[model samples]
Structure formats: C-alpha cells, structure tokens
Target: MEALSEVKLGPCRDSPYLRPLRIHYTQNGTRKHWDFMQTHDSVSILIFNTTRQSFVLVKQFRPAVYMCECARRGIMPTVDTASKDCSPQSLVAGELLPASAGVTYELCAGIVDKSDLSLQEIAKEEVLEECGYNVSVGNLQKITSYRPRWLQQEGTEAYRRGTNRHTPTVCAGEPSAADYWAAGGECRGHRRS
Candidate 1:
C-alpha cells in the first residue's frame, strides 16, 4: 500500500500566475517522494430560485488566477514572468516576481476531503452555504476539470518532486456554468409555498 508519512518544506517560489511549493515526504514501500508543488482541487455549483431568473455569482480573489492580471495589463512585462534567475542588483531593490497579482473573478469553491461525504455532496454543501440555495445531488452536472499547464518550465520551481504525482481538478469551468436540476416529488407544491 502507498502511504505518505511526514513532509518537510524544501523550496518555495512564486510568480504572478503560480505558487510553487516543494514538500519532501516518505511514501510506498521504500523511501519515496510526494510533490504538492503546483496543484489545485476545487468544486463549483449552480443554484436556481426559479421564481427569479437572475442567478447568484460569487466574487472572490484567487492568488494564482489573479497573479497574471498585472502581466495581462502589460504593466509587468513578459520577461518579468519568465525570468528565473534574479540578479544581486534586482534583489537589492526588494522586488519579487510572481505569476499573477490581481483580483480574479471565480465561482464559489472548496477543497474536497477524504471524509464520509463524496465530492458531489461537498459541491451541494458549498453551493448552499455560499449561494443560500438547496441543490439536488442527482441533478449535479460535471463541467471542466483540469490542472493548469503553465507551471512547468526551465528555471521555475513549479513542478514538485519527480513529476509523478497528479493533482485533482474538479470544477465546471465556473460556478454559474452548471445547470440546475430540481428533483421530483413536489414541483407544484414548492412553487406554491
């Protein structure tokens, strides 16, 4: 069985778009490694109050997503994002290069845990807590799930460990991207009350 034991911080670096972290750990049979360098796992959902056509959108700032805003604006040139070697002069100025550094618009989300609940259940709970609406689990639809590909590059510490570990990606692109499904039993009664 593959079991992870103890983790120690090795190296850390950041850019406007990504935060790279290196954690050393022992796993599996012999001495192994576990990397959590640039990984993201999240959940998003949609809730409908059919009575109102307008939908609820959660506004939040994601450090990884927003770090690119400065670069996108051209205020922080591309070289600033690609350069890994920092000169002694640059360090004297007390400047740090990052992947992205701005406020980003994102759906309501939270990380999934290995508890009794499933990922679907976690999604429903987050939607209700963030948007204040009850959602049907069976009606949940999967959107897009992925790990960003911009983390790997020369001179960057984005990739963690030996590059074998995989991160879990769970989101339907955006929170509003998912369609709402109402379960049966009291369609007319729910609207009336």
Candidate 2:
C-alpha cells in the first residue's frame, strides 16, 4: 500500500472526504433548507473462504470511526499528534489512542463513483486493492446492498448524533464463520444473485 503524507484536516470538520450539501424542500406545508451528506454510495465484497470456514476481512484504522470512538469514550487527540503513516507499524507509533480507538474489521469496500464501472466491477477492484486477491467480474456476484446511514459523526444539527446507535450492544471476540452466520452478520456460502 502506498502511504501518503499525513495531512491534518484543520479541526476535524474540514475533512476533504466530506462536502456540505444543501437540500431545499417542502415539509409540513413549509419550505425549509436541510443539510445532507452528498457522499458517494459504496460497495462491499463479503468474501468467505469456505474451505477454511473463515471470512476474508481487512483490519484498518478509519479516522472517522476512530473519531466517534474517541467521543464515546471521552478521549481527545492532542493537536500535534498525527499518524506519520497509517501502516500497521506506524499506526501505533503516535500518541496513545483510547482503548476504543482500535482497528475495525470490515469487508473490502470502495465508493461507487470515479468510474462508469458496474458495481460488480467495482467490487472486484476493491477485493484486489484491499485484499490483494484478484477477482473476476464474472465470478463476482452482488449480494445485499446497504446504506450504513447509521454511521454519523459530529455534523450539522440535522445530522448530529441522535443516540449511541453506532455502538454495538455486544462486543464479541473474533468469531468463526458459523458464529457470524448465527449472528445474522455472515453468509455461510457465496450465492450469486
């Protein structure tokens, strides 16, 4: 993975990945302007290594997720502290983070923009880019599509956190594929749609 120079986004709200959006519409017979996120739609490839009964997952530090974790745990980042490099080794070489600020296990995913490629093609690219396993578009099948709308950060009043909905009610240690299936979070086998 190519490591880019560490760039601090001013005070957090000025993130380059996010842009403020204005939506004007009528609600309850009144015209109002609401702020919304114009973020790109995303796709995920939930790869299950059936032979090994394990899922191919990626563990990385998502600064956004890390921010919410910090707020939930009342931990703050020191101004001068920044991760020089986000690699596994360099990630831990900075000021100590809260216990909640740990890596997250997620499927290979990417935004559905930047190209006219279909979702299947995008999924294959993510699998290769994030998991290092080249996948063919023919073999890549689409499954459930999700919005992940629950993931909210400190934003405008319209998008502020309503509750601790992002927090998982139960924290389980790394589980097997079976465990994941039982929890309604995993697909036992790959089934093309």
Candidate 3:
C-alpha cells in the first residue's frame, strides 16, 4: 500500500493585500508545518528590442529580501513576521543594507486582478508602466505563464495559477523612436509624457 498525506492551510494574519498563513502537512507519516505568505496571481513581460539588441528591465528596492540578507549576515533578523502583525510591513525596520544593495533588477510585471482587462491587456499595461513601452495587446505574443521567484519564496500556496509572458517583439512603434532599448547599456528614460 502507498502512503498518503493530507495538507491543511489557514491564514495567520489578515492583510488587505496579502495573507500570511500556516500550512500543515504529512511527510512520511510525520506531521509537519510551515509558515508563508500568499498573494494574487501575476503577469510578467519580457521587453526586448531587436533593433537595439537589448533587454529592458526594472530596478526596485525589496524589503523582505534585503531584511533576510541582513539577518543572514547577523546584521539583523527577518522580523518574526509569522509571530507579530505582518499587516503594516513596518516590521522589517531593522538595520538593513544600503538602498543600493536592496535594489533588484527585474522584468516588467504586475499582479492580475482587474476583471475587465484580459491577460494580454494586463501584460501590455505592465510593459507600458514598468518599461515605458506603448504597445497593443495584439502585438504581445504569449510566451509562457511563470510564477515569480519572490511570490513562490513568500509562500507555497496550493492554488494553481499561471502568469502570462509576452514573446519577443522587434518594436511596438517606430524602432528608431523607442526610448528604452540601448545598444549595450542602461536605460535612462523614466516617466515619459
């Protein structure tokens, strides 16, 4: 006979955006439990330009990752979020690395929620917001549905979901006019009117 295991999950704290939870399961007939964070499904866009032969990405400061790094180096602790209120996110206020170290380079991405817009439409919007690319949803080619690493790291929700990514495109508009694509350097363009 094969052994089986049952898993139980419940929220530990109430947050408007995210729900951190406690998960209990059976492993080799032994009961085990883990704490994690849960969030809505999301989409990521890969903005690459063929004319410039470059990829567009974003840089943002992530508190959780930085706090964890600090904790690892004995600089500080991860702020036992599982125990205290995780709602404010002010818990990670411990000594953290410089802002430069916390900044991460990432692709254009956003959470999926607006019911009116289609998945492709959402991807188009994210590309525009994060990468400043004005392109139509039709122009976006479906690449694959990928769960972001940070999302997975926060918690392992049993909910099966997919995040659509657009395939590579030469240029949504005039190739020469696009601002983001650089031959082999950083993109200085931000918040274009």
Candidate 4:
C-alpha cells in the first residue's frame, strides 16, 4: 500500500465529483435544515473467486479515514472544530499517525458518471479497471440498491455480484489502473473463511 507522508489538508473550493449543499424545509410545521453533498450514483461489486475460494478486494489509503482516525485519537481537529484552516501546519504540529491507520480494504467500485452506460456496464468496467478482471456485463448480478444517509443526497448505490473464474490479469497499462497503482493501491484476494 501507499505510504502517507507530508500530509496536508485544505478546503475544497470546487469539485466535479461532489457538491455540498444545505436544504431548508418545514417538517411538522417546524422549519429544519439538512446539510448534505450531491454526488454521482455509484456501483460496487463483490467479486468472488470460485477457483481460489476467496474474495477479490482492493486495498488503498483513504485520506478521509486517516483524518477521522487522527481526530478520534486527539491528534487532529474534529469536524465541528471552529477553525476552518486545515493546513498541515495548522493540524497537531509534528504529530503524525501511521499510514496504516488510513489503509482500507474495499470492494471494487466506481462512480456512475457516464450517461451512456448502464449500471451493469459500469460495474463490469470497475471490476476490470480496479480489480484487473474482465467480466461481461451480463454476468453481473444486481444484488440490491440503496441510498446512504451520509453526504450522498439522492445518490443511489447499486451493489452487484461478480464471479472470477480465473486468475486476475492486472491491467497496469490502463490509465485508471496505473493511477491506482501509482498511488500505492493494490488488488488482492482474501481467502474466505
């Protein structure tokens, strides 16, 4: 996995992936507000390797998870902190958490930003790009769909089931695959218990 060093944090001025917004509404004759982020719907695939009796998973470092761990450990500012400046120097100066704190194992997934492709197609592409496995769209079984109560307002997440019949061929040549590897991310199989 990628090692974290010289970490820095700052305000997100603009992002194509997500937009933060607050909604004002009247509930039970009382006015209330809810803050959330508008993001593209996404798809996640659970890849099972029948040959190896394992699950294919991706391991990567998540900055958000790292920051949360830091805040929980009292080494960084919490989300409710009054100060908005989140520069590295503004955080607990000289204190740093191990990179392992941010490492996470996750299912192969991707955001649904393309308007032309179906959810199954997106899942197939994600499985190939992230997990280095070529899977047909027809083989992707839609398990269920749900919306997370977090910052994902109105964004639906679809989970699909995929089976890997052969060994993974890492597509390191693909731009997306290369980018993930360049950032110290990796794909591996976890034996099922």
Candidate 5:
C-alpha cells in the first residue's frame, strides 16, 4: 500500500506541522547558534499481538528516508537545490529510487495537535486510525518519553498494549498488516523479554 511517485522537492516557507527556528545562545562563553524545527509533540503505540506472538507495526513510505537513501546511493539529482524543480526528470530517465527505498516500519503514531483531547485519547484515536485496533485509552501503558535533539521540541510519550483481538483492519489509505509484516522488524528499543 506504499507508493511514492511524481516526487518533487520545494522550499517550505510555511507549514501547519513545523516552523523553522534558529536559536542563538552562549555556552561556556562561546556564542552558538543552532537551527531546528519546532513541531508538535507526538505519541507512538507499540501494538503487541499476544495471539500471534508478534508485534503489529505500520509500514509507510517516508520521503525523508527515500531522499536520504537516494543521497547515500549517489543517485539523487543536484539541480535547483533551493527550488521545486527536483523531479524524476531531473535525474537520468531510469534513475528513480525504488519505492521500497523509502519504506519504513514503525509503531502506530500520531502528532499531539488536538487541544481538546488528552494524550491517551490521542493515542487511542491513532491506534484506530492507523492500525485499525480499537484499544481503550485505559489499556495504553505509558512506557517512557524522550525528546529527539534534532526536532528540538516536545518529546513523544511511548505506550504499549497487548491485544488478542482479530487481525487488524486497514483504514482508508492506511497500510495493511500484511505490508507491516512484509516490512519486517521488531519495534525499535522494545524487545520481547
């Protein structure tokens, strides 16, 4: 269910998701500046399927991952670095990166942008929307929270839940469990003990 096509790159001047920021500060009397993006906090749910003895994950194409893979493979185009003209045509006719290059397996996650919903509520909604599991907010066990230095914003509070319900169903435009399993990996940082 992951297909990325007609790829293009452009400068982002405004976005509802993130804001570019530069902070100037003095560390040990040395002036320093760091550029980062300010974004909403997020939550990730590790859906453990007790019946299957495996974890249920989400698989989707990440453009950032694709671009990084292309760059690493030395196949990315170098034209119009600051503009939106970077498209498939910018590279050799057959140089497009494979769709799988961008694919990633991750926990069901969503941003904490709704003001009226509590963190657990948002997590519950994400589980239903992304993973098609109707898990109650009370069943979500908080594991930990940590902010990634690169994002420079509030961290994601991780949760885990064990479910023996029927196989997960896919919401519209969401990846199916087959794709998730095909992507193949355990939930990072969490292992069966």
Candidate 6:
C-alpha cells in the first residue's frame, strides 16, 4: 500500500457532481508530476439487498473504463462447474446478473475527509447516503481497502453492455451524478456476441 505518485489535473468546469479545487501531485523523484492527478477522495459499497438476495449495484458512463480493457477483465467470473445453472461466461452473458457478477457494479464512492470520522463510520454513512439503507457497522464487511480500480469509472459495463437480456432490477436512490443510472434500463445498445 505505497503511493507511487499523484498528479492533479485541476478543476472541472461544469461538473454537477464535484467541486473543483485541488489537483493530485505524484511523487517523481524530487519533482512531482501532473499526469498522475486524481480526485481527492471516493467511496463505494457492496450492499446486499437481503430480501431480494441481490447486491445493490450502480451504473454510469465511464470514459476511463472505456479507455482501459478493465471493463472486460474485471467482471469475468472464474469457472466453477460443480455448481449448476452458472458459469463465468453465462453469468456474464445472462439476461440476469448473479450476486457474484454484480460485484463489479460501480457507484459514487467518495474519499473520507473529516478528521472526526473514522473510516468505518464513514463507510456506514456512505452506504446510507448512497443507497438509502440503514446498515449496522457490524454487518458491514471490510473488503480490501485499496483502490485497485481507481481509474475504472464504468468498468462494470463491459461485462454488462452486451448482456442486459436479464440484468436485475435495481431500486436506486437519487443518483449522485449523471453517470449514475439505474442498474437496468430498457436496452439501448447492448449487442450480443
């Protein structure tokens, strides 16, 4: 968990989601570079809608996910033939998403800022704020605390774009940003292979 470098690109003009102020500066020897710039903070949740046996997932148009092949690799589930009615490709290709395939679903997650709040507390708050759910701190599972896909704004779409034939129906909260669309909408451009 070492920060290699950070670069701030500067403020955005008409971003309805974020306020522009600071840019990231990356460590490059004695000089920090601007190419590694990034957002100040972000958060996401892996909410399980217990009643539906479905995970609460978010969707948005991600330029970065489109830029990288992450959209393809991230949602690709490994095969387990012992189980019936599911395979990685089938899970990916199915009209409906399984609990596992929904893992890559992205939402508007923010970085913890206030000094008074602990990360766990912040995580609980974010889940409530983003999804309108009241979850206990004990119920929250602390997954890996790292930004493996800091750049993947919409990588979830990759496994999803051409396969919305049976995607789950999501009960979404008010979207934090334009990228945040409901989990499944009437298919617009999902093309099957």
Off by over 4 Å in 4: 27-32, 77-93, 148-193
lDDT string for model 4 (83-119, tens) is 5664434455468888789878877777878889877
Ordering by TM-score: 4, 5, 3, 2, 1, 6
Judged by TM-score, which candidate is best? 4
The Cα local distance difference test for each model comes to 0.44, 0.51, 0.53, 0.60, 0.59, 0.40
State the weakest 10-residue window (summed lDDT) of model 6: 1-10
Model 6: residues with Cα > 4 Å off, grouped in runs: 1-35, 59-105, 147-193
**Comparison by TM-score, 5 against 6, better one:** 5
Off by over 4 Å in 1: 1-40, 46-55, 61-103, 152-193
CA shift of 31, model 2, Å: 4.2
Question: Cα deviation of 11 in candidate 3 (Å)?
Answer: 14
Q: Could you estimate the TM-score for every candidate?
A: 0.41, 0.57, 0.57, 0.67, 0.65, 0.38
Model 5 sits at a Cα RMSD from the real structure of: 11.0
Off by over 4 Å in 2: 1-16, 26-31, 77-100, 146-193
Q: For residues 1-193, could you state the per-residue lDDT of candidate 3 as single tens digits?
A: 1111221122335565466567799999999876655566667766666556666666765555655565577765233446554433322334434655556777666777787987778877766666666666776766666544543442343332322222222223221234443322224323222
**Candidate that beats the other on TM-score, 2 or 4, i.e. the better one:** 4
Writing each residue's lDDT as its tens digit, candidate 2 over 1-193 gives 1132332333334444455567689999999876655455667777765546666777665767665665565544344325543322232224435433545777666776756787777776666566555556776766555434545545734346233222111111222334233312223222111
lDDT of 4: 0.60
lDDT at 31 for candidate 6? Answer: 48
lDDT of 5 by residue, 67-156 (tens): 888889897766554565553335444677777888788777778788998777887777766655556677676666664433332342
Q: How well does model 3 score by local distance difference test?
A: 0.53
